[model samples]
Target: MRHEELFYLLALQKVEGVGDIVAKKLISHCGTAENVFQTKAAQLKMIDGIGSMVLRNLKDKLVFEKAEAELRFIEKNNINWTYFGDEKYPERLKHCIDGPVLLFASGNINLNKKRIISIVGTRQITSHGTEFCKNLIAELAPLDPIIVSGFAYGVDIVAHQAALEHNLQTIGIVAHGLNQIYPKIHKRYVSKIEENGGFMTEFWSSSNPEKENFVKRNRIVAGISEATIVIESADKGGSLITANMANDYNRDVFAVPGRITDKFSQGCNNLIKTQKANLLTSAADVVYILNWNFETKAKPIQKQLFISLNNNEQKIYDYLQKTGKQLLDIIALECDFPIYKISSTLLDMELKGVIRPLPGKLFEAI
Candidate 1:
């Protein structure tokens, strides 16, 4: 976007009572942020939700000064930004009514045609949660999905580290501005993370890591990804907030099931019990639920002949070959395997290039 337009948009954000939804409405009606200011009061009053307070606030000239200062900060620091209408903005987030009109980013972040998943959990991560989180990323490494997290301690940092270990792009959706790191100790990971993925936020350079900012930040972590996973959380926490946001966005939510007596597992258990999230056991659950196709790059058709399949995989491959395409449940029943076993087996087959997954949980021999 042009500097002139961005300046207007930033000023529009400073207008009290005008938020992402209202700004979007104004922009959509006026065609551009600059045009919004140029539009007549009578014309603006015709907009559905435009009220007296919002109209009055738009006249505040101080917003311009603030916008100018922030713009200078952006230029001086070489900060990267994306407007809501820009093609480079997160495609999934664009559909969200509350998504930020402008997103500031740093590092080599790219979301084009990428499989993005957000992993969020309690700051007090348990040993089991850490192992589960790390193993999950490692198992999903071959699919090369981008990992999204809050960049906080516990599960957030664990997910980022796991993604980095596998050399996959990992994005840190921060609660504060990009001008400073929140925990201070995490400054060490900044360079390494920027090398692969990077940090993203809607806050300005002048903003601080306030308490309320995290709830707002949760929306981005939820909205930007196709799915959100909770490795561990208490009955109430920020991770649950993120899960609810993901559910509200109509995206898939998954939680690792744990013992009933464990405090950290209560939230995940409750989510599963209430059917708010799918019961996540292994990477195969994600692969099956998201219907991810592992065979993106081209490989010779004859390559499957050279690959070896175990007894269960061979059975499914033979069945799929004979039956053409079949539902996951049907395959499980026909192959005399449980649903959990069938899901893992199908994912394994997909990774081995012997079978391909289709839409709606259907699979066929390659």
Candidate 2:
């Protein structure tokens, strides 16, 4: 982004009563933060949700001071950031109405064509929760997914460490600015995390680890991933809040079922009983529900003149061959075919002996 544009975006964020949702609405209507500032008061007043009070606050000069300071910090620290419109911004987060307008990041993080999931739980993680979290990462490592979690004590730290041990990229969604690590003792792991992955936050350099910031931070953790997994939580905790936010975003929610009597297990058990979350037993449950399969190598074969197929059918055939047997629904999604179309095509291919139908609506290329 250009410096002039970023300066206005930072200033827009500082405007009172302007939260992420409101800021996004304004930016969408005005084209850019700089344009929002350049537009006349009459034009701005015509926009929905732009009240007299908001208009009045937009004139405050102190916001520019704050923005200038933040811009200097960004330049001095070599901090990397992505605006809401930039391609580098989290794709899933763009669907969320309340996602941050500007996401500040650190480290060698990469999300290109990668699967992402957020793992969250209580700060006072038990032995059972720790073991489950680590084992889950180890099992999922082969898929090469980007593991995301809060860089906190207990379950969060354990998940990040497990991903690191497996050579998988891991991300820590921190509440505070990158200027300092919260729970300072975790400083030892900072260098290592930056090496493989890194930290992300919406907070600026002057922002401290305030009480409400953690609650606010949960939204990014929930919005950026395809699913949110709660390893363990008390009846009331931040992890549960993150799970709730994920559900609100319409993302998949998974909770590791545990003994009902345990304090930390109460939240997961309640989530399962209420049907708010899937009963997660192992990584296979995630793989099955998310419809992820092990990538298979294509078996080279010469073309057969007797077989006839359309472009869509050939694509489906190749996908089934590369991924082994898959459910009918998953086949349509992966092969980019419509459900109605895929069913008939698969039946035709099955009759042709190019593919075989298995039990439970699965199909495999023969």
Candidate 3:
């Protein structure tokens, strides 16, 4: 965005009671942030949720001074930013009511038409969690997904490192501003991360890594991605908060299951038990649940010529071939097979290269 528009936006954010939702309301009503400030008080009052306090706060000259200072900082540091309405903004986050109106970013981050997933867990990651997290990223590396995390110690840093090992893009959604790193020790990894992916935050250059800032940071991590995966967590933690935010955004959530007695597994177990998240066994679960086309360049195989199909498989195959593409439930109902039986049969057929799964739970004969 241009300097004047961004300046008005930063000032608008400083206005008391004008959060993301309210700012969006005002922006939508007035056409732009600059317009919001220029709009008449009578006109602004007509907007829903726009009270007198907000109007009075909009006139605060101090907000303009702060905005100017931040704008100067942005210009001096060569920082990158995106407005909520910008085409370059995270697409999924645009749908979120509470998504940040202005996001500051650094690095070679590219999210366009890419599969993005956020992996969040407890800071005290276990051995099992580390192995699973690394393996999951490796397995998913073929699809070239962008890995997102908080850039904290345990799972977050591990996920970022694993992504780097595979030469994949990894984004670190930070709690504080881009001006400083929270955990001073993590400074070493900053250059490497920015080389492939980068860091993103809604906080300003003047902002510090305050306690409440982390909770606000969680929403961005949850909203920006297509899904959120919990590698490991205790009974309660920030990862769970991120998972809940993802769920609220209608994004798919996955949790790595573990033994009932494991301390770190308790949170994941609870998420699965309550049906809040899918029980993630392997990367296949993510591919299947998200309906990702992992094998985009996979060559077609004439399975019927070489592979033998069982009676159930043949029946489903014939049905799919006749219908072209069909839903899993429709295939079960049409082939007179129970839902449970059909799912396994379909998986067998998929492995045999006789059928292919499409997005939205659809299947077609290959």
User: How close is each model in CA RMSD to the real structure?
Assistant: 3.2, 9.0, 4.8
Cα lDDT tens digits, model 3, 1-366, are 598999999999998888999999999999999999999999999999999999999899999999999999999998999989899999999999999999999999999855999999999998889999999987787678999999998999999999999898999999988999979999999999999999999999988989899999999999999999999999999999999999999999999999999999999999999999999987878876886664533345565464477777888888888999999999999999999767656765665567878877889998
TM-score preference between candidates 1 and 2, better one? 1
Clashing residue pairs found in predicted model 1: none
TM-score of each: 0.89, 0.82, 0.84
Top candidate on TM-score is 1
* Model 2 deviation from the true structure expressed as Cα RMSD, one decimal place: 9.0
Can you list the residue pairs that collide in candidate 2?
A: none
- Candidate 2 local lDDT, residue 59: 89
TM-score sort, best first: 1, 3, 2
- What's the true lDDT of residue 62 in model 2? 98
Which lDDT value does model 3 have at 156? 98
Worst 10 residues of 2 by lDDT: 293-302
Backbone clash tally (model 3): 0
What lDDT does each candidate get?
0.92, 0.87, 0.90
Give residue 325's lDDT in candidate 3 (0 to 100).
93
Q: Report the lDDT tens digits of candidate 2 across residue range 1-366.
A: 588888999999999989998899889999999887778889888988899888889989999999999999998998989889889999999999999999999999998944899999999999999889988887676667899999999899999999999888899999999899988999999999999999999999988999899999999999999899999999999999999999999999999988878999999999999988999877767765676544313333336832477788788888987999899999999877888667657755643446766779899887
